[model samples]
Target: MLKIFLSSTYRDLVEYRAKILDKLDTVFDSVGMEEFIPDGKTSHEICIGDLKKSDIVIFLLSSNYGSLIDVCRLKEDCKAECPMKTGESHISYTHCEFKTVIAEGILHQTYKVLKGWDTQDKKEAILFEEEF
Candidate 1:
């Protein structure tokens, strides 16, 4: 079975995420922070490791950029600042996950969902039109 890693801002897309999971559950196994991440593993380790194991990645984007965290800064060995930490950098966990997947040269697709709108309706409509 193919493993799919779903990437998106959790708080911003709770409803959309649930709908995606429900749709994906019938076909492929899906991985996300809420129901998949194992205990004892750090967020960075879990995300990167799981992303590496996944066959494909799906990104859900919105107007909200979400929160950012400096993984390099948190490490004791790395003294250099995170390259993504710039004046206009809105590197959320979802962003980092997407970057990691790209850096690994994995297959990915992105879908834009409007913020403050009915995400389930938008997602369902889009998925229905797409091959998926």
Candidate 2:
């Protein structure tokens, strides 16, 4: 059976994920982070594991960069554990996923979400694409 992985900003694409899962599950073994459990690893780590197993990956991108590996501002105790490392800057989970897709040479497709992006956020995804 073909395995497909879906990636996107969760909140904004909740509806999108549902609709696509409904359609693809009929024909493919489609999966995403929604099926994931809190299994001692971070969400980012879990996703990279799933992404490696996928036959194809479909990325739903918007102006929204999505969640961070560790949300410092949102957590009062998050200290210095959340900032991007020097000489290495990836603003969101989706950004890391995009880079991994390329590095792994995975067959993938990206669909721009015109409805969900937050116009106020920085366009870091586009910045990475620009380097390509």
Candidate 3:
């Protein structure tokens, strides 16, 4: 079975996550970070386990939540995006939703979809067939 890790904050992206999960379930076995992480679990534990078990980790980036570290490194510690300041707003960056896809460690082949976006190239899609 193909394993995938879906990572995103619990507040904003629930609906988007559900859509992605539904599509992924049709093709591959998948898990989300929230399943293993509950009210009391430490962030470190959940993050580590999720990254370790998943063959590919899909991080859904948002304008206020983009990670600063390069995607090429799969390690836990990286510079996090600066926390948004209240009472003062700044101009947002372009393509903020999918900015996390090109991080230092991410492979170019893995997908990076923004909100309401669909895969345009089916020829490069990953298909799994049962072992003979």
Candidate 4:
């Protein structure tokens, strides 16, 4: 079973995680980083441990545009814990790294929206063509 870490701005995408999980569980054995960590545990050790166990990281970028908390403000925290690129805005980081990771021939790449019937089952199940 593939393990995937789905990263998105907490303030905006937290609710969306449930919808994504419903679809993901249909095929992959997965866990959300927030779910695995005990409440109030913000240590890098726990976060990185979960990240390390993940086989792929899917970033839900567009979903975070209206986030009130501004996850970018927590850049230092994320940098200390996660494998994602820091400093750059979330969307930029997603766009930049997607190509580099794919060029380096890493995990399967995708960038289009994928949540419930809003995204067709056939499209969601199949890997995307090129970058999104």
lDDT of 4 by residue, 41-65 (tens): 5433344456556688676644323
Instruction: Output candidate 4 Cα RMSD.
Output: 8.4
RMSD list, candidates in order:
7.6, 6.3, 11.7, 8.4
lDDT of 3 by residue, 35-128 (tens): 6656564544455445555566666543233232223232234332312222132212211112233333432222334542242332211111
Candidate 1's clash total is 0
lDDT of 2 by residue, 34-104 (tens): 89888987776677788888999998886666776663132232122323543245367776667667767
Candidate 4 regions off by >4 Å? 39-43, 63-132
Per-residue lDDT value at 115 in model 1: 56
Which residue pairs collide in model 1, if any? none
Top lDDT prediction, candidate number: 2
Instruction: Give the least accurate 10-residue stretch of model 1, judged by summed lDDT.
Output: 73-82
Candidate 1 per-residue C-alpha lDDT over 1-132 given as tens digits, one digit per residue, 9 for 90 to 100: 999988887887899999998898899999887775467877867776787799999988765656666543433432223345453443456666665665668899888776554534444234322422
Residue 36 of candidate 2: its Cα lDDT?
A: 89
* TM-score for each of the candidates: 0.71, 0.78, 0.47, 0.47
lDDT of 1 at 13: 89
Candidates sorted by lDDT, best first: 2, 1, 4, 3
| TM-score: model 4 vs. ground truth | 0.47
Model 4 pairs in collision: none
How much lDDT does each candidate structure score? Answer: 0.68, 0.72, 0.44, 0.48
lDDT of 2 at 12: 74
Cα-based lDDT at residue 14, candidate 3? 74
